[model samples]
Target: MARAETRTHPDTADAALLEGGRVGLSGRWTADQGAAVEDAAARIAGSAAGAPILVDLSQVSRLDTLGAWVLERTRAEIEAAGGRLAYAGAAPEHRILLSEVKLRAAEPAPAPRGRLYGFLEDLGKRVVGAKSDLVTGLAFFGEVVTACIRVAARPGTFRGTALVNQIEQVAFRGVPIIVLISFLVGGIVAQQGIFQLQRFGAQSFVVNLIGLLILRELGVLLTSIMVAGRSGSAFTAEIGSMRMREEVDALRVMGLDPIEILIVPRILALVIGLPILTFLASLAALAGGGLTASLYGGMTVDAFLARLQAAVSLHHVAVGLIKAPFMALIIGIIATIEGFAVEGSAESLGRHVTASVVKSIFMVIVLDGLFAVFFAAIDF
Candidate 1:
């Protein structure tokens, strides 16, 4: 104990300091005393660098987290400046709290990751995500094939009620819109052909373009696209909602395969329904083309009918109709896969539903292109 000199703080919080690097804290050092405590700690740290300092808290009748933090901060600053500090005469509880605070305060924050590294990491994750989606799609496709085979072997296992219901929903209900859209498309094609051919005085050829295009490509393609957006999206939302409500899980628990019960009926319906819808859509489009040619292109109905009847071969009709079931298969696969992928959240349901429609539309277009190339190479 060297000769001690007393330094008293103007605030009641600090009380005084003694000689030989000793400081005394007093009174309630709560959040109310925050500013005064930090000020006193800073002064001591500035003057006592590399010196042995002792803190006397015997007079501190009360302490809280705020005051404990202040003292810990002072100790940290002193140690950083090459000084040694100690707490003496502290309560057991306070010592524990101060030690914990100091431990927490000393931990370093995580450094920021580099931008290039972040970009590479994100790209890798996306690639992995894309691969996962592809694998899931293929697995679902396989499940559909297996289920269809089983149904084929045991015809009694087929759910006719479910199949008919799905057909009514996905095909019958969709017929009006399909007819309207296909008619408009046919009329637009006829109008455009007439407009372009009028310059060459070959306006009679408008009937040929309308008939050939409607039968060979636009008929099936447009109908499939519409079905994918309308019915395909509905299928996803329906199954996804069932999945979210745990109905699909209940089917599994009851010893029934969800794929066979839920998916097969829809696939069967689409396969059976799309070709019929495609044919009706083709007829509607041809009717529109004939109307447009008669009214706009000034071609008589007989002439248009004769030209259309001559221009459209049965092979053209077969090509369009043949692609229908395949496109339906693609749409069904995409929609069902996305539906089963839904998580237990409304957000997940919405996202998967959107993904279903988008993926179905994209696949439908891709399949159309593939069909075009195949047909062209075979000179169909």
Candidate 2:
């Protein structure tokens, strides 16, 4: 066997041309040679140039796994580029190392999705999420009912002080704003009704329109939306803060039910407070309507009062009041659910609080629509 020889630095590998288009590798081909081994491999591969090339390894003073893998990768690249590479005179150990160090081909990138596919995927995800939320809401409602039953069974377990405090926060402090908004809405409605009805020489009927609309729809609906935005958001923030601080877990450690201690009181407060607030809101709206009638419609107080009394029935008042507690329950449940879902970050708390308000207000409006359909179907 005629061995090929290359003059090179003893520590770093080098490649050189030899007889019969052969490439001879010399010096140490190991990790210690680092980039030199890779450069030598690159030289061998580049020298192939669409023709057969032989690599004579007999002159290599040392060989390691890293050097073998680099040479193998270079061979693959050259072969992929329509060139040929062959090894000769490699020792048994070098042959085994080269045989065992095959390079895997890179995987291809995924194809891009179209807009219709992306839209369908997003819609499916949201539909699944909404279903999950509905199930969670129903389960939480059951837990709340169970807690209420337990408190009812053990009257002493009820937190009267907490209930009163929450009532003060949710209802008493909320009175001025609720009253003012309702009054302004009522005046606007009455003014519009008069303006439109006067064209038909029936401006007197504005009193009837104001009475029925305020009592049957606007009063309780506005109050529920305000409460959802105001006290519902507060509930979520308070409970979410406690959740972030691990106080909920602490309550469980103390052998107390957090539902009874924290949730029931707030819910009870909403249930108790909402009706009173609704009644007050209705009365304020009626007062505003009466004032608007006196000033803008040129109707006397006595005549407005008579028309209102004759137009509105106890049935309309009952229908509005009937929806109040259910609306309160919906708001409380949604708020508490969002609160308990809070994670350990301030951002999580803020996100859940915002979600709580949005969900509560949306559900309240839906509930009102359902009530309207039900009451109309049954002739209530």
Candidate 3:
């Protein structure tokens, strides 16, 4: 027979090799033993080394959860290394503790994906999501139009106060920042134009560039983007909060059409307010361009005004204004759609609000690009 190997830990714990590959454990086996119990368990696992072994626990004076967990983990490690572990002579309480601490094996890690495969997977998901969003947006738009028709048929259902309130929120209060930003942008464009054109002795043409660009594209585009970020986000957050609190369901119970009461006024306000804002923003940009021309391009204010008057046509102004209501409708629809998607959590509300702003801005830009192509094609 092989000489018995023994590892002892005074009164705390001990592991002793016995006859027939049996490991005898003794003394207190509890949290109080701490490192001694851990050390003994580790020794048993290492010595087993893919061999069959039986752990005898009858000699144990006390056993607790920590001791049981350590023993179970050691057994798991031994079994994973192709060894067999069995407990024998365990007291009833010790057997129960061991059963409770028999932890399940951890799941295996996933295989690493190739970069191209990962990219394709992500792209496919985004394309599918975009398709779904487009279909949902169209359905919501139809609902909004239906609501508008209902309100038009019964003028008494129109919420004039709500419309006025939204106009104040979306247009009047937004004027200061919109004007300031448009002014700065126009001034920068004028300064750059003067710098580029002076090299060719055609600095006076910068006035035509500023007038056409601001009236035809930049003015309404900038205003719409700002409104999407400001008012659109507000719409989503307001409605998302109401959704979280179940007020939307309450409206249905009360026989009130949520779309007519909640969304129509907001969309109508955007339709009315955006064009007025576009006009104001264009004027502000023109003023800024004139100031920059006088200061940097060696042109007097009166001369700049004369050049602007001669360069810009009503057709250019009409192009910018015509895009406003469409962009407004897009923003309002996207905002309300995301609002109604919110779940009963703050995280969902915030996520949908952000998505509303991002989607609105992206769609606004796409719509503008499409309009640009159509206008170019038709010679508008």
TM-scores of the candidates are 0.74, 0.75, 0.75
Which residue pairs collide, candidate 3?
none
Error of 2 at 77 (Å): 8.1
Give me the candidate number with maximum lDDT.
Answer: 3
What candidate 2 gets wrong by more than 4 Å, as runs, is 1-118
Off by over 4 Å in 3: 1-108
lDDT comparison, 2 vs 3, better candidate = 3
Each candidate: how many clashes?
0, 0, 0
Return whichever of 1 and 2 wins on lDDT: 2
Q: What lDDT does model 1 reach? A: 0.86
Residues 118-201 of candidate 1 have per-residue lDDT tens digits of: 999999998898799789888888988998899889999888899999999988998999999999889899889889999999
* Candidate number with the higher TM-score (1 or 2): 2
